[model samples]
Target chain A: MPEAFLILILFQLVGSALQTVLHLPVPGPVIGMFLLAAALLWKRSRTRTDKPASSFDSPALSSLSRSLIACLGLLFVPAGVGLVTQMPVLLANGLPIAVALFGSTLLGLMVTAFVMHKATRDRPSPERIPDTGGQVL
Target chain B: MQSLSHTLHQIYARFLPEPNMETLFWLSVTLAVFALGVRLQIRLGRAPWANPVLFAIAFVALGLLITETPYGTYFQSVKIINFLLGPATVALAIPLADSIRLVTRSLPAMTLALLAGSITSVVSGVLLVLLLGGSHDVALSMAPKAVTTPIAIAITTQIGGIPALTAAFAILGGIIAAMIGETTLRRLGITDWRAHGLAAGIAGSGIAAAQVAQRDPVGAAFAALGIGLNGLVTAIIVPLILYFLPG
Candidate 1:
């Protein structure tokens, strides 16, 4: 677990360095995510014949990643609490902020779902087909 | 009873004056409150409105208020957890890679949906804020409200938005999505789990994705994909759009 954490932190550090050096618009951790994904894909392809094809074949790394991602919600609590200090800004633009957040979220949800549903309606993907199999009640 | 109370208070006062002990106290309090929230959320069966983060924040905020702890002091004490967010975000690559491999066939449709949803989220949020006479900072912060918190913070800072405000708005947007996202999709006659999960991920991010994961593993996988892809897409396009905007 410690080794896995070290790897993640190293990737993040490298990503942050790259962002600073290259002036990338994206965040360092996000770039780290892409880099880690690319690394996993590369590692899988290289070891394909000798091992199983699962990208998450390493137990330590896989479990650690799963736990971290699972608690992604908890990770935001500290920052969200910072909102307490921004109470004045929030109060000043209360109506617009409220409307904009709720309205845009709903609109974004509908547009994504509608477009995805319509685009894939004619040809249901194989993975989604099984989801309906157990729901035939 | 009076002497015992005085003795306990003396111990606390002496121990808390040590910087390390104070840090430890606040850190433990943060985790304990969040754990209580998780328990309450489970007790409530993970209902949309029973969001653990929301509960935990409210509790912690109340604690701070009662104790009169400055936000900066509390933030400094809990900086370790905040630091972990970076590595945790990098850990998202595991599920993201797995989901990409699983949903290759639906990649095209998923990509299109992500693009449409992300663009709409940014444009609608900024436009609505401006239409309602919000300041430039508020509007810029609103641009990345749909992205995940860490990325949203970075994007907001990049585009001259207030990172703290963006973080707050992003989480609020996520909670709102978790509360009404499924019902809204169903009302619109969209029943496909993929679409449901994708929307939850794009707009609601982790909170909504966690909600979708309760009954649908496949949908959850897509939600993970949605989170990562939308993060990338919004990160790219927000700057591009702002750059091309008329000054």
Candidate 2:
């Protein structure tokens, strides 16, 4: 578990480094996610025959990941507390901020759902969709 | 009676003394408070608006304010909790990987949905802020309200907004999104799990995703995909919008 955790942190650090070097707009951890996924895919491709399957499926990693996901809500607590500090600003501009936020979110949701439903409404099921590259699911 | 009263006062002073700036003690208190918040949320059947994170923040914030503790001082310990956000976000890859099969099958549609949703979120947020007389800093912060907290903070800072304000708006926007999402989607006749989940994730982030996760894993999977992809899309587009549009 410790080793797997270390690996995750290492990837995040590498991601952070990359973000700093390239000045990418995306967050470090996000880049790390893609890096991890790509690494897993690469490992699967490299040792297709005899590598005792993928290490990403390890129990330790799974458990750590599950725990992290489960307690995900807690991780936002500190920054959420920033609201108290920003209370004055919010109070002064509360009306407009609230209007814009809720309004845009609703608009975004509608546009996304409508566009997605329309675009994929005609596509066949996952099983029937012909595989062109890597495994679909 | 006087001796007993004096003893009680001493005990109260000693036992309930001010929660000093001790790192370990405050750390434990923060975790315990959040754990209690989570338990209450679960007990209340995971009410949409009674979000645990919100409760935790209110509880912690009120405690700090009443105690006259400086936000900066208290953050020394809480920063550890904040740091873990990166690892937790990185851990999101597990679910993203799990859903890759479905994602790859409908790659074009999913990408289109993400782009469309992300663009709408940014354009609408920024435009509304400007139209409603918000400052440029507020506009920059509001632009990333749809993204998750960590990424939203980074984006807001990069675009010269108040990072703390962006953090607050991110959670506020997410909760508000979760509150109105279901009724709005149903009214629009969006019954498909994939479409509904994608909308929730794109607009609401983690809180909305959790709500979807309770009812349908497939929906949750798509929502997770939306969360990650939307984060990436917003990160790219917000800067461009700021540069080109300059609103």
Candidate 3:
């Protein structure tokens, strides 16, 4: 568990380094996510011919990630707890914010779904889409 | 019972002399409350809107209020939880990696959909807020309402919005999506599980993804994809979008 966590934190550190050096607008954790994904892809490809290979595919990493994400709801509670202090602000601007949030969320959901459905109409199911495995090799 | 209370008060008073020890108290309180909230959610059959986070927040907030503990004090003690957000955010890549094949295969279509969805979320949110006479900060915060709370909070910070408010709005978005996202998609004739999950996950983030997970694994996978990609895209583009907006 500790090792898996270290890997994640290391990825985050690298991401933060890139963000700080490049002055990117994106968050470090997001860049870290991309980096981690890239690393996993690289590992998966390298170990494809080998039998039961690559630590990237290890159950520890997968389980650790799952547990971390499972508790993700709880992780956000501290910030949500801060909401008590903002009740006044929420109450004051509640009407407008509510309208905007409700309207935009609905619109975004509808348009995104429509676009994806249209785009994938002629394609295979998303689950069956094959990986671009050999392209990098 | 009286002796139990006396012992608890004694233990609390022992920590009173040390500032650092108070961290333990608050952390314990948070975890205990949050765990109970989760148990309640489970017992309630995990209703879409019976959000555990909402319950925990309300519990902690009310606990602080009734005990007359300041928000800052409670937050300082539970800062450890906040720090975990970074690792949690990084962990999001796990699901993304799992779905990377699907994403790579449908890269163009998915990219287009995400870009359109992300831009629509920010633009419509900002415009609505401005049109409704909300402050500039509110507009900026609301712009990232389509993504998850962590990413949304970060985007809000970068775009000069209030992070706390942005977090609240993100949760609100999730609850709303959990309630009506599937129904709305069905009404629109979008029966595809992937499309339904993507819409809900994109608009509502992790909470909506969890809700989708309860019904269908494929839909949940798509929702997870939506959460990761929408968060990444929104984080990258929201600042630029906000910069160009009139607000």
lDDT of 1 by residue, A33-135 (tens): 9999988878776785666655344768888887787677678888889889888888999889999999999999999999999888454334433332111
Q: Which candidate leads the pack in DockQ? A: 1
Task: Report the C-alpha lDDT of model 1 over B1-247, residue by residue, as the tens digit.
Answer: 5576566556667668877887898889889988888888768865677777778788888777656567898889888888888998899888887776756878788989999999999999998988898878899999999988888988898889987788888888999998999889999988888898899999988888877777577778888888888999999999998776543
Error of 1 at A52 (Å): 6.9
**What DockQ class does candidate 2 belong to?**
acceptable
Q: What is the lDDT of residue A127 in candidate 2?
A: 26
Error of 3 at A19 (Å): 0.5
- What are the per-residue Cα lDDT tens digits for candidate 2 across B1-247? 5576566546544665554535665577789888897778667866787777888888888667555567887787678888988887777777787677888878898889899999999999889888888777788889998887777887887888887788877787888878888788889877777887898889988888777777666677888888888988999999988787754
Model 2, residue A67: distance off in Å is 1.3
Report the lDDT of model 2 for residue B241: 82
**Runs with alpha carbons beyond 4 Å of true place in candidate 2:** A45-51, A122-137, B1-21
Worst 10 residues of 3 chain A by lDDT: A128-137
lDDT of 3 by residue, B1-247 (tens): 5576566556656666576777887888889988897788777877777888888888888667655567898888888899888988888887887777767766777777888888888899899989988877788889887788878888788878888888888888888888888899889887777787788788889888787777766677788889888988888788787767774
